[model samples]
Target: MNSLLITSTEESTGKTAIALALATLASAQGASVGYMKPKGTRLQSNVGKILDEDPMLARDLLDSTDDLAEMEPVIYSPTFIENAIRGQEDPDALRDRVAENFAHLATDRDLMVVEGGGSYTTGGIIGLTDADVANVLDSKVLLVATYREPGDVDDVLAAAESFGDRLGGVLFNAVKDADYDRVSTDVVPFLESRGIPVYGVLPRKRELAGLTVSALAKELGAQLVTPNVPTDGYIERFVVGAMGAEAALSQFRRTKAAAMITGGDRTDIQTAALEAPGITCLLLTGGFQPPGAVVGKAAERGVPILLMQTDTMTTIERAEDVIRSGRTRDEETVASMRELLAAHADVDAILQ
Candidate 1:
């Protein structure tokens, strides 16, 4: 069974999303493909029953399973890593475990996609990171480069050099039309001269992010507040704690606005937000029993309430990743990202 590890030099570089897209495209081409997020922080569980966090999305996009635990492992807290290293737990041990799982999954499959952690050089001291794990699995890497500027090229080259002979190729992702022109015109030529193979430069589209949100809402059975809201007007800045609500609200008022996600139990916060005009929707973080009064207040005021089982911190982190990496424009976004990965991923080359 042959496999390739998809990694990036930083978080929100479209690593998981790109891997899923690749799997989907490859599958459409009639290649038997399977995907897995080797190491992750959050696990999807519901009312004593475990659920695949993004099961439907995974299946719909990549045509994979939600029942497979190895598909995504929850490894969020710092304590988890500490324990894994001290042998109190084997959190990072996912490298080989996922490898075996992929080898098994690849029995009749054409290609196995192993998605990496935050970045290739991300393992903490005293433990193996994604790069080390890739080495252990002896899999070549497919880098997801997400960038918006010229520095992106340097970063991608950096990662490529760090991975050395393990570099399979590069995927310039989330690019805009203009950026793609600059890259394939100037940047790509330079890299090619240095012996790098730019596998594919994918364009940036709102469809990708929209697909994630829509799938999440369907999986959680959460309702959309404003279905007609333009993707461009969607809220980009997210505030987690109530302490920042005032600023968040003020910012939303300036923009066309989309949704305001909060906690169902946060009546005080909800009421305060209700009093404010110019807001679109409200998302309650925790899955708690909503009181009739709160529901009445929200409905009467025409505010949409989205309820998510995940806590505030987890929700915030997830939302941030989606927003930061969710720019929906054109080809330049992809080219810029690829260039960035090429620069920063050169850990070994830089050290030398």
Candidate 2:
């Protein structure tokens, strides 16, 4: 079977997104696909067993019958890191478990998409780094590079050098409109000249990257003050209400489907946000109960008011964490992601 290892230069660069998209494309072409994440870093407990989030997502999306436990063979729990650092955990044993699980999942499959934990060098301590796992599976590497600035090219080049001939190609993800010209006219040509193949350049779409109100509420441990708010509604931008009422309104007006974060006591800011178009939700901090008038107005405007006990900065940090770790579980987002990947990414080249 042909195997591909999907990894990134850093975390939250949409490695899973690209992997899932490729699986969909491959399935459309009548190829049977299998997925496995050898070393899972994002640990969550479902009932009694510890599980990784991405493997479960893959199981559901790909319609795989593999047991969740087997699909994610190794989970780095809170104490796992501590144990590994102190020489309590054995790297060889971990590798054996991963290999055993991988063999089981890859049975009767044409392609196996193995996802890495974080970056290329993330699991070095456990001897299961991206390159290590790729070598173990005899898989070619397709690195997902998130475009932040021009300097990001250096990071991608360095990773390419590390992978050597094992590197299949590079996919440029989340490229903003402003950087498209440079990435296409400059970066792509530059990389191609250096013997690196550029497989895709996907543009940034807010809907694909933004957090939903339901996700935000869950992340902030927030209480919904408004009844029957659409939790699935996407918040494309976040505006902190630290300025005066007019300034806050002006800022909020700049983006669609914005979530305004403000102190609960700031009725002026609250009122301004509610009045603005495309204000999907309000995130009230400091545990202060919003006045009944503001709540009533929000209810009237059909805007969800999420109340949290944390302070403003803490609230912002929590929101950032949610966005960074968030994935698209909804069908709408999934369809858009597939469309984007199929349009921008060279699926033919990847499958070849």
Candidate 3:
């Protein structure tokens, strides 16, 4: 069976998001697509609740429940590489386990999209780094490098130079709107001249950023209070509370949003928000347990309250963190992803 691995040069660069985008494009072309996240981390709080595992996200977006292990078996932790190197664990066993999972996924699927953990330069002690998985699966690598500053292009080129033939192409993500023309005109030529295909230069559009509210809650290693929150349409804008109750309430009041995000423990803020007019959705951050009163009020008002365990600061940080990384429907770069899937024509071909 053939599989393609999507990876990045660093964390939070939208690896899983890009994988899903590719799946969206492939499914459009009639490919029976399968997805896998070889290393699952940042697990959910509830027992047996798997979260931030790339395979699960891939399967959910693809609308299928393939076996979790087969889709991805070797989950990674901070000490994974350390333990493996000390001979406390077996890398080959982990490899075999994931391979078995892959075999199952490959049986019924025409194309399987495998996502990597962290940057391509990353490797855990248990023997599953981006390179290890790439070598084992014999899959071509599509590197996602986010452009945050002037030297970002050099990093991508260096990664390509480092990986050499294993590198299939690179996609420049999270690019500023002003630099789009410059990147396409100036940067694209240099990269192409060096024989590295600038697959596409994606503008720093918010909509194309990865994971909506519900998805963020899942990834934050928190409990999911509202499973199916509306994330498909346009999110008007986001407002975060930095000061205490007065500041939060005042800021929240200014927003006429489809959704409002705040700390779960901020009862004063929550109470005010519950009583306030014109908010359809409430996102409680830092996993704060909502007061009974707030919960009851929200229910009566028919407002959806998402209780995520990430702390107020961390939650807001995470939200704002990925805001620039979110995906949208209006960008030309998205069109490029669609185009690549169409050009490939076969999942098996890319996998091979």
TM-score of 1: 0.62
Using lDDT as the measure, name the better of candidate 1 and candidate 3: 3
lDDT of each: 0.60, 0.85, 0.66
Ten residues in sequence with the least summed lDDT for candidate 2: 325-334
Per-residue error (Å), model 2, residue 223: 2.7
Off by over 4 Å in 2: 218-221, 228-233, 236-258, 266-280, 296-303, 309-314, 330-332
- In order of appearance, the predictions have TM-scores of 0.62, 0.87, 0.63
1 or 2, greater by TM-score: 2
Ranking by lDDT: 2, 3, 1
lDDT string, candidate 1, 133-244, tens digits: 6776677778777658999888989988887888877777667777878876787777778887666666655444333334335434666544443223234344442645
List residue ranges in candidate 1 displaced over 4 A: 46-67, 72-79, 85-87, 90-95, 124-126, 209-233, 238-352
Per-residue accuracy of model 3 over 67-142 as CA lDDT, tens digit each: 7656657556546556766788887888888777777777777777888877776655666777788777777788
Give the RMSD in angstroms, all C-alphas superposed, for model 2.
Answer: 2.9
Residue 33 shift from truth in candidate 3, angstroms? 1.9
Q: How high is the lDDT of residue 212 in model 3?
A: 49
